[model samples]
Target: MTDNLNEFNKGELIIENKRDKRLDNALLTTYEGDTLLSCVYIEHNSLPELSIDDVDTTTTFFGKQVPFPLMINAMTGGTEQGVEINEALYNISKELGIPMEVGAQDVLMEDMDTAELFLGEIVEEVNRPTVLLSNLHANSSVADIKVAMDTINADGIALHLNPGQEIFTKDGISNFVGRYESIEKAAKEYGDKLIVKEVGFGMSEEVIKKLVDVGVKNIDVSGSGGTNFVEIENLRNFDYDFSELYEWGVPTAKSIINARNISKDITIIASGGIKTSLDIARALILGADMVGISGEVLKYLIHGGYDYAKDYLQELMYKTKIVMLLLGCKNIEQLKKTPYKLTGKLKEII
Candidate 1:
């Protein structure tokens, strides 16, 4: 078993190597250029005409008043390079008054030294009333969840589900049998704090119902049609097994619509392929309480540096204001009630 584990770790290292090599290429190709999907489309004759400053963007999340309803989604934070990325993200998040989520803490769960080096230090450097979120894989034990939360003093624990990524990953764990039960157990044990998040693949209406039944309060609709984790994993492994599944899950816009229709009580975070402020507005109109950004920001930060990423975020903010003004909405809540037509693939899904 030890030998098997060692081989698996080595394979993972190789996959990581390939991923890092293609990182710049992917970012440059997708974001710096424009082949990426925005996942938002304005209906014919539906554009609103208004001044940008007249648009209000403030919204409340987790009882905290955030200036914008945007969050930097969990991306990385176990390796040395992850530490630097987290620090840069922290500074930008603090300045922007947006929440930030760190990558999964599986490494920290195993080693106290690694926890202190990677997770603990990142949280400390971000020193602010910022919404600091910690992450755990769905199969994480209750004890592991507690350790992850305690290690980072997380404002909320994000339980990430990524079975598709696992299947494509060369050295991945595929024991997703009792994830619902495990999440339920964690929520029951730590009901006041934990937030469940889907990674890349969106949650079904059935799964959403089950989670709500299990007492989970917050959900990130990390839907499909954005950052294709299956594609990413397949590229890393040189495999085509799950390539079809790359377009398998629901879109972020559709997920938010389904989730809102089912339960308006839980906080809904719309993510997946969200890249611009127009995407943010479309999500809000569809009932997203907050929008989580990852791939787009990662692209900028990794290639162009922190200043470039900050400017990108500022551009998104500017776009969001324009969206609000056009919709004749003042704040995020008004944006939610703003009338608009959902067409294209979004109409088909929702």
Candidate 2:
């Protein structure tokens, strides 16, 4: 049965067709009723009053200077349709002058031809000085990590932790038990390049400390309140009884706060459920070095096409500028040190 499921998972049907449906369902389920970041409140009263024009949005990551502290998070690859999506995303990223990350490179690691055909095309198309990020699952070995990174000429690799997805998916790979040592080993071996990331489920202060102890300098809080991978996997299964739990995990704002409280040295990339420039501003204020956009970008591209996505990105930039001006922030650094008030669940969690 597992073999059959593996075959079912391998074909183009899984990613090409099912992927869209999964994404749609995940978005609907995650953001259907209320806003996740609603719990966070910006205190304009007690905080220093500033204008949006004063905000400086420039930021640096991994020694690369980014015009804005925003990255298009790893979205899709390894399938034929994924190539088109990647091209569209890369084009937007290039136009916006922000860094971008490719989807998981597991397929590339297994098949060099696929890497050249898909990932290589993406790199070539986005011929700008964008920060290219490669990806691998946490369970991947040191060799797998190296291959995944080298496959795409990644500026850095995002080692993702998705135990919930692995467990929830039908025919999912079990025994995702030995990631700590593997992460440590990968960090030691590729400390120069890899950026460890969490998928949906947020990382805690304790987890951040452990990763720091293991020599990780970069961490992406791909926290919850965005694309619910468990929900996506559950949609794929259709038989899961715990579908409601898809709404589980950390909100992007809270995750940023936790990350900031734990380690000031590690680069924090806020993701999971990020939509607007206000969300980006909130993340930066909460202590994220950069913010990641995925599901929203994909939705824009699917419904409104590439031009629409570009417009959306431009609007986001405008919103970011407005936020910075209002905060009187001259740059991304100032935004980070800027004061923000937390309320609701976020205040409790923080």
Candidate 3:
């Protein structure tokens, strides 16, 4: 609300509607593909001397231990609905002691005032989430990263790769030539603090290997089985037909394996279509250091409001612990090493 409603900046108007459109599309769309997490089944332990009370979900994010490995992930910011979503996700992250990576900070560079509105009263240090990550695009400059982090007081910055969305969206970047070089430079300056992420289409072995070779440590595959930006952009305009690309991208489970195969030092964040406790456990078992849920969480928040969102995540945590107990794992480390077998299409791919 920095500008007058009557005379809104035309550029901001487009972004505002785009943000609203994403949420609107998300509210109506249900993913039709599989994340292939079902292929990863944690072998149940009949006797481990571990009770339900002994199960622990704690894991490290940005070098800080949290109650669980699940993160809310980047969704939106800079608009009215964007503000609400950030605040709700922020509160949930704070209460649950998890990370919350906000959507791209492109707006913060233009208008710093929106940063205050984006995160709400939590702009103050003591009130923010335990781990807050600012987001930017893959082709962003180091200066952009610094400015975005400064504007939002973020602990780190995530440089996201979304070539598919960029190619299809109106006025989106078509030439993605220097993204890797830019990311390499950012990784050098930020070290492990920089996260190179894929925007839902998932990451391939080649891309994962390239990122690892460039000194990037933190990675969010953001694999398929969740939200589809191409579909969202296509839905935004019914005149065009993008139905053929709906089933594109790598599944979340397979994406994690791709990263894991690249290097053990690489920190993997499994996301995209993470809905159930089984999904959470499967992600961990598949080599994800942490799990992220965005589309599903947004769906809950939109339909049930803040209270419902909180309750839904709480129940998810409970169910995740139950999965750990069944697997005879007492903590995250145990769960990571838990036995799993691959079946179906996923089994053939990896």
Q: In model 1, where is the ten-residue run with the lowest total lDDT?
A: 28-37
Models, CA RMSD each: 6.9, 6.2, 4.8
lDDT of 2 by residue, 213-307 (tens): 99988889888887777767776686666666767777777777778888777788888878887788788778888888888887777666677
Off by over 4 Å in 2: 1-36, 45-54, 120-128
TM-scores, one per candidate: 0.85, 0.87, 0.92
Model 1: residues >4 Å from true position, as ranges? 1-54, 117-122, 125-127, 239-241
How would you order the candidates by TM-score, starting with the best? 3, 2, 1
Scored by lDDT, model 1 comes in at: 0.73
Global CA lDDT of candidate 3, please?
Answer: 0.83
Number of colliding residue pairs in each model: 0, 9, 1
Error of 1 at 85 (Å): 1.0
Q: Please give the lDDT score at residue 234 for candidate 3.
A: 78
Instruction: Give the clashing residue pairs of candidate 2, or none.
Output: 51-325, 51-326, 52-325, 52-326, 53-325, 55-329, 56-330, 56-331, 226-273
